[model samples]
Target: MNLPHDDKTCGWYAALPPPQPARRLSGSQRADYAVIGAGFAGLAAARRLAEHEPDARIVLVDAQRVGEGASGRNSGFVIDLPHKFALENPDAQFKQRLLRLNRTAIAQLQSLVDEHGIACQWSHAGKYQGAVGERGLAYLAHFEKLMAALGEPFHAVEGRELAKVLGTTHYSRAVFTSGCYLMQPAALVRGLARSLPENVELLENSAIQRVERDGLGGYVLHGADGQIHTPRLLLGTSIFTREFGYLHNRLLPVMTFASWTAPLNAAQCKRYSGTFDWGLTPADHAGTTVRMTQDRRIIIRNTYKHVPKYGRSVDDSTRESIRAEHRKAFLARFPDLADVPFTHTWGGVYAISRNFTNFFGQLEDGVFASACDNGVGAAWGTISGTLLADRAVGATSSLLDDIHAVTGMPSLNPPEPFLGIGVRTRIRLAAWNSRAEV
Candidate 1:
């Protein structure tokens, strides 16, 4: 349950300019407030706390450099729609409320980007949810029904339009929603870290070992290099919250893989003959997510693995297998561009729940925690982190209440071997069922 130290070999990280060397925690430190995990959630929480208490000494700590974890590893879609397979919530109003929350997060992010002039390739180009075969079409149809009930307008695109939007003729059915935006996640994280308020201390490359309360005072956050004593602490590490036994089996680690093709040359782009800068999510929950980067690179994310406790990254064999699957999926969607090969491939962890609900709230006195993005980490993490900060200071809002009711405590997972077996079996079955989409 240690915070991840492995590189995870994320293509997103390597594709960007080299990050500045991380400043590790040195000697001893004390803070008025401390947040563990510098991903979206933790960063948002720390930023919010600083806003509310500007003069307070605030510390934001991460296991790796900013944007190196799930925050930076995500597909970079700030989706207004809910996460995949997240409609299990019976309260219909919650869906609309969640959508509002998502938009709020997006607005806040945009404000930061504009105010700081962050160079994260932030785009409002929207996204396409495209379906190639009949199965994917069915899923799209279901989404249409849901969107219609919510009174949301979604433009259905197909034939030449789909081809032009997605850079391929594989999609016979597709819909474009204006709610989502795309970006280079690594850049966004680094930009966020750089833009943080001067009072908020940002600590990176500090793997937290454990948290223990001092006998007569505040909490002691023991890390690899040093210790931090703080009166207030927030846990935003998400999947690794299991280390503190706060979330326990309420969340499970689900790893997803993505491969980025080498940027297509001008001739290659012409031969592909589709849009060069666009992003698309799969119509099916288990289908592949594709993004045609502004740089003319095609990235495909398709496989999911329930990485074990001791490991967060996929092994070489799994990587090879997914590489083949990526190529197959890529070719199916873009047979004409078969020669364009992927330049980078990697996997990142997501915390899914047994019942598909994410969680948020206080764990103990002076300790607040938020996790379980369900599947959409970018927006969900941002909103949850902001909400957690409010909760920490006893502030109340309608959005915070909605998060509380919507994310109710996660369902208990089955015991170890059985839980792992059940999750793996379900993933395999679901992947096989969605083979056409994947």
Candidate 2:
């Protein structure tokens, strides 16, 4: 199924000055390594490959602009081993394995930000998963123990301590980790792309139309303007998995929408935000994640699968209803902001797999793949990219075992046959509840 493109975006990164226009492929060319999709995963692979083979000719191709996809559209939260994992009881044998890799991903990302000196407003203020009710608090309280038993570091903060960390009396309990960070998503992507070695080429507004093996070890990637032949190809395209046939079927493309409030002043900031953590994402599904930028714009995002549209073109009635619900949620969380106008509203498609885990491995000879971030792309994307690059360049990593454990099948690309019905039912129920609340 061809999903429509939804291109609406607003964030600090979107506000940055545009970089020099990238040259779309003009003629058939070859690179030592070719990366498709210039988002976090692709960029990570390209950057890692450059590190391993400094002189290797590397080329990155994106259909749109850099960071224009899920990477740029995300809330810019760098979280490791997110709650999605909690939903799935991954085998105990490799629980630590995933956590270690996640920690590594976060550290490596920060290292890159520092080494390249990319001024993307990166910070390591950590995060808080506050519980809104007894169930949420109970889950969070147990999560702390589970993470501890798994040898992962986590702290449970509650009461005044929770209030201190979250700067809100609304939170009765919370989990605080000093490891996560918030960033300007598009800025970081652009910054990283800019910091790449001059030898690496980036082609923007260039979409990969076809991929065929060259009969040799190399593969030919056909783009609109031109083509590329490379010995090694990394597939970093997520969400738009149909472009790669099999990869698409193994993934779930879910649409997540976010809205941004006009920048809040000092009084509003005191009333809305407290500490510099990335954002206050509820431990349970209250259907909202709240973030305040350095400039004090409040961003609230929610994931709901509807008629998939990559670009934010919705009917006037639907848009108005969404806006109203978003506002209502914001006010419930922060009553002081009830009257505040939201200056920007937009949404994007982020990919996830049926099992809710990122699938990464080689797809075909000389072609590797890594995607399905499941809404935690910042850290996982980095890890997947680095691992793929390492595998390509023949580097050793203990993560290979866990990587092999994630089996990919041809059936993953399309939504399950009954998924549309399930999704529609959930939407209707949510709408009914919202109306009943009135």
Candidate 3:
């Protein structure tokens, strides 16, 4: 199947100044190591390879510019907590492992941000999982039990208390936890790409069209404008791993939508927001993840779609419908700020498995793959990419074992038509159940 590619961007990218011009490949090239996809995983992979082999020629390529794809399109939460979906069981040891890897990922990203002095609004205010009704609150309370069992630190807060952190008294209850960070998603990824070591060459507008083993023991990557042959190739293409026929039916390509409100005036801020900026995810899985940004805009993300394929942007009708849903969410939370228009709305793709697993291993000769973030890309991507590079360099760590144990190869998905119907129906039922939270 052909992997989809869309430039559908959110307001995060638009809020920033124009980015640096992209560098594209124009001719055939050869490298000692090549990492495909310059998102968090690809960026970390290239950096780690350079760290281990500073003199080695490492090439990093992406179809769009850095921060233009899903990496840049996320809500900017670098969370180390077990994501809501991670509550598969009461396995305390498993929870510890999940949190440990996430912590390592955060530490690695913080090191880069400090070393390179990247200004991406990197905040340590953490995040909250809040609910707006009894049902939603029950979800938060259930998650609280798991957190307590893991010895996690958190404080429960009601609507008025929660409003101080988020600036609106919309949520009925919440749990404030440590170990999460929020930032401008696009800005942070761009900064990471820009700070890459000098030994690594970053190429944009260079989507990998196909890959085949060259007769001379190298993999040939055919880009639109050029080709690259490398002794070692690391695939960090995420959902597009299907494009290379690696994770075919194992990975599902799905879409999610988000919109950003226009900047609020001082009076509006005084009336609507608190002194501090904060981010929060819904207590309900199908609900919304919202952020009261540092720059005074309210960003809300909700709703999911099953788009098994990519390459084309979503239609305007879809965008408008999501925008309407976003509007509804906005009004529910901040009816007083209903005038705050969603300046930009967009969608991004996520690769999911039946049991929320990721893929990390050798796909073919000289081909190492690390992808399927299971909806937690920022921290997961960083750690997976770093560890993948280690695997490629023959460097072993206990973390690798944990990765293999938890994120085993994805289970097979149901066949299409039925698959589509099943997924769509599940999402619809879940979303309907979470409608109050949304």
For each candidate in turn, the TM-score is 0.97, 0.88, 0.97
RMSD (Cα, Å) for all candidates, in order, is 1.4, 3.2, 1.4
lDDT of 3: 0.86
- For lDDT, candidate 1 versus 2, the one ahead is 1
List lDDT for all candidates, in order. Answer: 0.85, 0.72, 0.86
Off by over 4 Å in 2: 1-4, 86-90, 159-167, 270-273, 276-278, 306-309, 312-319, 405-417, 426-438
The TM-score, computed over Cα atoms with residue i paired to residue i, of candidate 2 is 0.88
Clashes of each: 0, 12, 4
| lDDT (Cα, tens digit) per residue for candidate 2, span 1-438 | 343365544555466787787788879899999998888888889888988888889998888788667788888788766454543465676555666677888788788789989887788767777676666766667777776766666777777766654545666777776767888888988888888776678898888888888888788988767899999988888766556675655566666677778777767666654554357676655346777677667777764655544454355466556667778767766676666788766666777665666667877778888877767787778788878888787777677665555434434433555776765676667645433121
Clashing pairs in 1: none
Predict model 1's lDDT versus the native: 0.85
**C-alpha displacement of 51 in model 2, angstroms?**
2.1
For candidate 1, the per-residue lDDT at 185 reads: 94
